[model samples]
Target chain A: MKAVEFQGLEVQYGDMPALRDASGSFETAAMTAIVGPNGAGKSTLLKAALGLIPSTGRVAFFGKPLAEMRARVAYVPQRASVDWDFPVRVIDVVVQGLYRELGLLGRLRLSHRRRALDCLERVGMADYASRQIGALSGGQQQRVFLARALAQNADLYLLDEPFAGVDAATESAIIAVLKSLRDQGRSVVAVHHDLATVPAYFDRVLLLNRHVQAEGPVAETFTPEALARLYGGLLPQLS
Target chain B: MSALDFLAFSAPPMLIALLAALACALPGNFLLLRRQALLGDAISHVVLPGIVLGFLLTGGASTPAMMAGAALAALAAAALIELLQRSARLDPGVAMGATFTAMFALGVLALELSGAGAVHLDVEHALYGNLESLIWFDATDWSALITPATLATLPPELFRMAATLALLAALCWLFWRPLVILTFDEGFARSLGLPVRLLSAGIVAAATLAAVAAFAAVGSILTIAMLICPPAAARLCTHRLGPQVALSLVFAAASALIGYVLGGYGPLWLGLPASVSAAGMIATTSGLILATAALWHKR
Candidate 1:
């Protein structure tokens, strides 16, 4: 089943087109890496799919509109977009994932706290649950965010630049977590920048350069020719 | 006068000031967290014209009329800031400063034109309120406190402030989760179908209402101070939102009581002839508290 499908997705920032008529589909039970050069609208595509920004396009999840299935989707924005000095504990950030099901006035019961801690544990951040979010390291902060997403228990996860500025251990840990999600038949789509790890980390790859250059299984679509076209032949090593 | 007389004269205004401070401080934390601290200043200034307009239209500065005017004025100020920010591409600070100054000037001009300068809605009272004038004179004796006539004698501003506090408290209690989530992460809150716009509008309305209710006793400047300083001081002491809010309330109450005492009686001990402005003293006290907290936190 298709986890997310975008048809004629167009985004403009004041007159410049950020993403021009991009169309693609992400299949379920697999991990997809949205790879592209700088200013390639990789983040814009995820934001558009989640309806976080205004774009002229049609997006669907499980053959239905995103609005109807919003609750089943979890999103992790770029870490740099958040204020590190925000006064919240690591556990509080994770508990926010349960905010939807808990409703406005719903109290966090012991069961909910346990589930949040469990998610934190999944990301190897259980020991830092009581620490303020601002006190964590860069990779630890990213893991806390991933823990928050895990607490949501959404079937489809959209992450932006989760692997950026992380140590090798964290990079492998995140990939392992994404693989675990894919093993459970959940869909994971991430905006990835590194080209060397594309084939090894992701099952499906969508190469974008203001539009979809190619999208398919990594072996078939993520070819040296596609890299050359997307990168304007600048990536001689890949080519 | 006896101690009872002192208590009777001072308790009502002090309570009113405390309630007003609490009302403002509750939402102040959210404003500080959202980095919209100047919005409080803007709302307070713009609501002056609304109060004046309400007084002009009603022929009396009644509570309902003043509240409606203040709410409308605050909403207009907020809208104008947004308009100027978007259309003129002005910085948010510039837009707020421009919009509020213009509204406040219009309010002052309206007061001058309407010939309502002699009333309590004058410019002096709007900027620095006469808290000492809110004295309860109905009780001939302390026994009158139990009588129904005590209600008639009680300052109406006190009840208005108390009611506003209740409403603000209820709103904070009811929408605590969404407000925190939205302030921290707007995109995530929206993706969760949390009605981010409506929640923001509701918070703005509550802040306006609190500012309006506090206007008669504390004035706009003091209201802005109360809305910002206590929460800011509390934030320096705590990292969690819940603790920050609680500590802010405590700080607000302390500032009100201590400032009221210092403004009203401290001058007497120093051989002064009259008390200082209680609202000014409260604002100053909050500033001092914030400064102290900042120094301590830095240390």
Candidate 2:
């Protein structure tokens, strides 16, 4: 069974095609890593699939439309996508994840606060809940974002570059969390940048370069030749 | 500065400025945080054309007509900015700058082309406004605070400003959560099924409402000043969004009070014969406060 699937998806930015007829699917209850070269429309693919940006074609989750499953899906965008300098506390951001349950004007209660703290605790960031988001290091900020995604209590998680610029400890902690979520039968999809860690961290791999080059189990698909073809031989390590 | 004299000659304009400053400052928090602070300046500028056009069409500056016109023009300017940013691939600041300058020039041209310039629609009025003349003659003393007839004689602007402030505050409180989330991370907000586009448009709409209403009570100068200055300064004073917003309002009220008093009576205290433009003074005071915040943040 597929967790999420897209067919013939296309995105154009001012006459330039960022994504071109991309068709792919990730299996249910598994971890998939979307690996691509720079400007390969990796982030654009996630944005388009989630309806965060304008794109042609449709995406479905669990054989149902996104609207029907929105409550069950959580997304953690790239940490650099937002202005970290924004005056928001770590707890406030985590609390935002509960906005759907909180309703439009629902006040945060003690229970809500406890739940948010629990999410922070899972990320090992409970102590920094009151600290400003901007003051945290890159890895810590990324973990805080993951905590926010966790607070949603969703069945599927979409993460964009979750490990980029993070420290080794943070990277291991994040992978452990993702693996735990997968072990619990939830699906995890991340736009991963590190070529060396693909097989070690992800069970499935999708090599995308404006379109899907190859996609299947990481053992069968994430190879030097596949990456060489996807990156047009630009990646020195692949050589 | 007798009680009666102050009530009759000064209270209305001062109160109007305060209310207008507060209203504009509230939305300014979101704008500054989202790096769209100049949108306030743009909306304030575009409202001039709307006001002039409304007056030209209606033959008088009716409050409803002026507000509606300003709102329409602000929406148009915002649309143009978005179009330029999306289609033309322009930076947000550059798009806002281009759109607002053209709209403001259109307003000036409309004022000149029409015979409205001879009336109250002059550029000077658009900038400095008739704040000094918004006095309450019937409110001669403290009794005027409660007397129905005396209160009825208060400047219409005072009521308009108060109503505008209340409406903006209520709307902010109602949509406070979505507003903060969207301002912080638009993509995450979208993933949450938060109607990201509508919330974004709502923010611009609220800003237009605040800018147009404030533009009516004070001039565009004070409207822009209070919108960006207070929020920008408040951002430096606090790292928390709620506290920053509260501090922005405090800065706004302080600027209004200090600037109004200094503009109105500082000349008298200095033994000068006349006073300065309250709108300009208010803008200056806001800038000073922003500078102070920057320095304090440095510490």
Candidate 3:
């Protein structure tokens, strides 16, 4: 089943067009890496898909439009976007994942809260449950955020630069989690920063620079020629 | 005072004080978290016009008039700040400063023009409450008794209503973890499929309501101090929201009581005016707590 499909997707900020008419389909149970340089609309494309930004185009998840498919999707934004000094416990942050499944103003059942704690344990953070989130290290905080997504229990996961600043161990752990999700028939679209890991990490790759440069399995589409065009050739000319 | 007096006397005041503390502190947590700490400062200052408008419209300091006026004007100020931030590309600080100063100025001018100049407010009394003055005022005394207790004694200052409202508001917040997440981390909160905008609007409304209710009894200018100083002090002592909230309430109650007593009696023994002297004492105490916390945090 197609997990995500973007048709004539375009995104803009004020006046700048971040992503132009990009179209593609990502299959279920596959790790798809969205890669591009700064301003390549890598973040914009994921945000647009998650309905976080206004874009003129059709984006669907599981054959349903984004608006309708919101409940089935979970997102983990870039770590830098949040304030570390926020006064909340690690569990308080994770419990937020149950918000969608619970009604707009509905209260969480005790059983649902237990599920949240269970997800925290899955992320190896059961001990950090009561600790203030601000006290956590970068990777630990990322794992807490990952736990929040896990609590969402969504069919699809959209992560934006989850490994921007992290230790290698944490990186591998995150990759393992994504791999585990894929094994469970869940889909994940990660906006990856490290170019070297593209072939090893993701099953398929969608090269973006304001448009769909290419889309196919990483083994075939990640050719040296495609890499040059996305990074070397287009970057200097645009700037 | 007798032991019975201690038990009976403090209960009512403590209850009111606790409620007021929570009302100011809970939303204060959000404003502080948002780094819009000064937003309280701006709203409290500008709410003068709203209060005056309310008094003028109703021909008195009635509850509906006062709260409605404050809310409308405060909301207007917030909207204006948003507009300035969006259109002029002004930083939030600059926008808030501009919006508040203008609203406050308008409020002062309106009060003077309405022949209430003699009663026109100064900022010091507006931000902080004269808790001593509230000692004599009781809500139960004024109306037909709702309960048997009311038949025997006068109700305390209507401020109890504000406290009760604060408790109700805080209870709402306890269930609204999703709302707090959105405020502190909008991106991730949205990713979880939370209704980020709706939750935010609800919080803003709650914060506004709390501030306005507290403004009626505590006064406007001091409302910011009460709202901000306690949370500021609490942040030094705790890292989690629940504890921070608890600490803030304690600080708020202590400030009000100590500030009230010192202002009332401190100047009688010394050679100072009670009102000014009391405000100075509360302000100094709150300032000291905040500074000490800051220094401790640095250490």
Error of 2 at B225 (Å): 0.9
Per-residue lDDT value at B221 in model 2: 91
Sort the candidates on DockQ, descending order: 2, 1, 3
Best by DockQ: 2
Worst 10 residues of 2 chain B by lDDT: B120-129
Candidate 2, residues A78-169: lDDT per residue as tens digits? Answer: 99999888888999999988988998878789999999999999889999999999999999999999999999999899999999899999
A59-132: candidate 3 lDDT, tens digit per residue: 88999876788888989988999998888889888888877667556767889878988988877788888898
TM-score of chain B of 1: 0.93
lDDT per model, in order? Answer: 0.88, 0.89, 0.76
By summed lDDT, the worst window of 10 consecutive residues in model 3 chain A runs over A230-239
Off-target runs (Cα >4 Å) in candidate 3 are: A101-127, A232-239, B1-19, B55-63, B83-90, B109-160, B163-171, B268-280, B295-299
lDDT of 3 by residue, B194-269 (tens): 6776666555566677777767666655567766888898988887777887787778777766765565567766
Q: B1-299 in candidate 1: lDDT tens per residue? A: 68677657888889999999999999888888877788889998898788888999999868788778888999988878767875677897899899989999998898899877778676677777767778888766777778886767788888889999998998899989889889988878877877877787777777778888887677877899999999999999988999999999999999999999999988998999998999999999999999999999999
B96 in model 3: Cα distance from truth in Å?
1.8
Q: Per candidate, chain B TM-score?
A: 0.93, 0.95, 0.79
Instruction: Please report the candidate that would top lDDT against the real structure.
Output: 2
